[model samples]
Target chain A: MSPIATAALAKTAPPAPPRRRARSGPPTRRLMAPATLFLLAWMIVPLAMTLYYSVRHYNLMMPELRNFVGATNYKLLLTDPTFWHSLVNTLVLVMACLAITVALGLGLALLFNRTFPGRGVARTLAISPFFVMPVVTGLIWKNMLFHPVYGLLAWLARELGLAPFDWLAQQPMLSIVIMIAWEWTPFALLILLTGLQSLPEDQIEAARLDGAGRWQEFRHIVVPHLGQVLYVVVMLESIFFLTSFAEIYATTSGGPGTATTNLPYYIYQNAFFQYDIGLSSAAAVGAVVLANVFSFFLIRFVAGNLNAGSAR
Target chain B: MAIVELKNVVKNYGGRKAQGPNAVDDFNLTTRDGEFVVLVGPSGCGKTTTMRMIAGLEDLSAGSIRIGGRDVSDVAPRDRDIAMVFQSYALYPHMTVFGNMAFALRLKKLPQAEIEKRVREAARMLDIEHLLERKPRALSGGQRQRVALGRAIVRQPQVFLMDEPLSNLDAKLRVETRAQIIKLHRSLGVTTFYVTHDQVEAMTMGQRIVVMLDGNVQQIATPHELYAQPVNTFVAGFIGTPSMNFLPATVGDDARSLQGEGYRFRAGDARAAGLAGKAGATVLVGVRPEHLKWCGSGDAQAANHLAGKVDVVEPLGSTTMVQVDVGGQRITAQLDSAIAVEMGQPIALTCAADVLHLFDAQTGQALGLPAQA
Candidate 1:
């Protein structure tokens, strides 16, 4: 283009409005640097120490002698019968708690979505369990509700003309699961109920006008509408459930021959009670890898579910 | 087709003894088989509540609604065999157009072939056959509208209830879709009860329009009757664009003249037949902007002209609207754009002696209509 043409175009283009200078990226990056570095250090330090300790035999009992034993700690942990037992116990506990909380939570959410007298008070009471501290929840169940001889169950059994049953000793894993599910069910209710409320009233009304009964509406409309919400609930609850520790610690403490010892409890037992730092670190590393695997699979599954839901 | 009737239906929200007023009170109307009736009002006037009553979505508090001579006040909406098109269209987002349209038939346990045939026929009728496999979220607003109509059509219901179904569309689409719906209505000939707040919709689509205010029926009349001779001030003011202008007036004590805000008309200039004996009583004089003509020639009808300064001239392509101030009262005068007019142009507008309406001031009931033989 000629300079004359450029000048003519510039003149006729109304001289583009004065632009305000935007903040450059360097200042923003500088502002974020400290917090980002701190978080990175906070996460990396413990993880690096765990890795280093897992490879070397360092016990508080004999701190002067520490030497690298390549793959020995991992092989020992993998071959231990107690480790396999606790892994099974962990699976059973996680699955059972998820089933109980999700099923019961769905039922309660449905019931609470209806309008009735005192419904607000009832819903608040139903959600109160989620607010209870996990340790408090554990003790409330262990001492006041599940005591073998003098708990609420024992008293009730005596009043009913039956012998008292030792609940925790007989079913240690079952007791832990029940306690966890009770604490988490309200979390599920809070999420699922919100999903139910946001379901369009027009769709429900249209279904009713389409001659669908209550069960059909639930099966076709409400269930599908709540699908993504329930998926999120399950994923979140599963992540929390897999690492559950406080309830078991307060109640079972890996008692009765490791019956309630999930991975977290077992790791604590090896490190604190058994004084085997190498074995505990190895077990902790195993748990972390397994959790990452589970999370990866769950995220992929939910992504697929999301795509299928919207693709149609 | 079924005739729909509502007999003094009442709906009160919350509870019966709740402090709030009733939403609908003692409403009554009857529609013949294949009749198109529209309930029109401002928002919160209970037009929607009244239509819901007819569809059996809301239970009447005191009165009974009958369809085809059977009492259905207590019936369920589904059992009443009525189809409704909601303003949101309410299509199942997860389902394809065919599935949404065929949902009711599938619920009735119809055979697969029959459901397929009926859904296809309806889809073709709505000209949405190509969109049958697409979900509602994938369709445009106009396509979803057709799907909604097809859903209602496949049911072959006894009555069609539409609650502001076209209010969501842009203006051009709304007009086009409205014409299509009227054509479909003519072909189907099903009794339809439509509710809208747009007076134009009520005027153009309904065989008879029911104007409502404060949950009470103000007037139920044909569009022609409603435009020509509104029974009261509310109906008169509501039924037109550039709405009918009202002026404070009184019958002169001598009974030969009409004294108004800015001008007086002698006995020969203004003829109010029904207001003959109401001498010395204050009345409201209503005049449509179209009836007020610009006085241009020496032979102008000057005896009944309103003189004012033009405040604003609004060009409306075929015509122009000029807001005029006469004394302390403001009124609009619609005139031909060909008749040149500009801002601050002082002018006089007149019409024939019979083109004036007299309404009682307090009650607002029409005393006499203009030019009624």
Candidate 2:
């Protein structure tokens, strides 16, 4: 039964007996225990390990030097120029990809909203990009589209009488941005298409009869209705973008003098390449703080909206 | 205010098949200036499609629509000079009541002061003035609907199209909103075309109600005319609650009476006129539940009576509705609540001659009914 029908039935139904209520109370808490404990161990253990490693002078290269460093690793990593550069790169990658994907996704979603021949097949094909593995996406773009000599783009450039360009070498950051955006745009499109579909047709009809042209209807009715869905999309995309790594690893590999190295790549470099556990742990902690700060504002905005929702 | 005319308007969703069955087939009507017209039918009966065509929301498959004598077949919906209220109360969720009401005027580039004055006036009329600053998400369903109404009222468009605006409300609130819309129509006097699947709303609100079935108009008449003289069995059945009952009968040899299973009745002169030469023809006898009263023996209207066993009795405060099984057919009778009835009790039902309706069995079209009576 639908929730509204269930609610109405509850309203008209007699209240439950005291014995039935008492019987339901204990099992509810018991049923909730597994998920509660799982979430706590899942989130808290890794957080505890990161905090533990950040305070110690642990370096995998020389295990004998393990001792309490007491903020030294944090201070050194915070002052590093490469750390600042990676931070800037991370922000650029996230912001650029977000802008590209959202803009393109919104346009595609609007286009797909209308009835056209082959819409189901077209939508399925359009959404396929989101399902491709990130490493595969990187490899495909690198070898098939961006390579200077054998790539499709190179062939097109030569056909147009232009020089073949080395995309990953000369424009590593842009290449990574494009690769990541190509994969993630479908995520935005799917979410935004669902939102567009959920928009009531009556609203659009009402707007038209209210003298709204196509553009005005889109701006007033469509945009406002899609606001919450857009917020969810941005929040999820930004989080995923902040932790983006596979594309850069498979293609640029943080090369060209740290041009495409984001915070995750920086942590990987310190932990796996330099074998400096404490510093990488400190960097990982910083990334966590950044993610928390982003979520804090977004959750506040969403909660504020919820609290203002229709109620007596 | 303008006269809205739909000339042979038709709608069909079938692409590339011009000969396909229409959703709204060749509907035609012309409204007097400032008239409140309602299109009512069962779902998929083309009432909503007809209204949408007038609003220019749906393209006419053929024919043209005119507003005050100007053809609007090629005009866009935005340029058609109309406003609509939707069943879902489609208020812009992000906008305050004030903003929603002011939207159309602002789109027209009306001065800010004029927009404010018109919005405030409409809000006052809808009793939503105090909710001007609240977003639609912050309002109750009824409040949101008022804002939707206010949104249309502020536009003061040449025509008002409403598609089941009260369907989303609770029953009590729907009735209240129905009265409010009627009052709004009386005051503003815009040429209005309202669509609903509800016969009650159509009867209560429309100056003239258009009954439609299977994309074709069944009849166009006032509530009184529709209730008293439905042109077909469909209209007669659709317009009443509990609906008009149908029983197969044959004209008596004398042609002034009807003979059905287990019963016989005189088909009064006016009702028998069309059966003059069709002595043995099968016909359908129609009578509304209210018109069939539970009568004891020796009642004054003894000329027409059906004897049956009461199968069920529903005693509402004002009246008792009893379903009776007569022979193999069931008939409903509405009687005074003071009259007691019992299940399985043999009962007699009497209907006055003027209230009896006769219809051709095959065509389901009313017969022996004067057109203007």
lDDT of each: 0.86, 0.89
Interface RMSD of each: 2.5, 3.8
Model 2, range A142-170, lDDT digits (tens) per residue? 99999998999999999999999999999
RMSD of each: 4.9, 6.0
Task: List per-model TM-scores for chain B.
Answer: 0.94, 0.97
Native-interface RMSD of candidate 2: 3.8
Steric clash pairs (candidate 1)? none
Candidate 2's TM-score on the B chain: 0.97
Chain A TM-score of candidate 2 vs. true chain A: 0.89
Task: Score chain A of model 1 by TM-score against the reference chain A.
Answer: 0.88
- Candidate 1: where is the Cα deviation over 4 Å? A1-35, A296-312, B18-20, B252-257, B264-271, B297-303, B353-355, B369-373
Candidate 2 regions off by >4 Å?
A1-24, A27-33, A293-312, B293-296, B299-302, B338-341, B371-373
lDDT of model 2 at position B96: 77
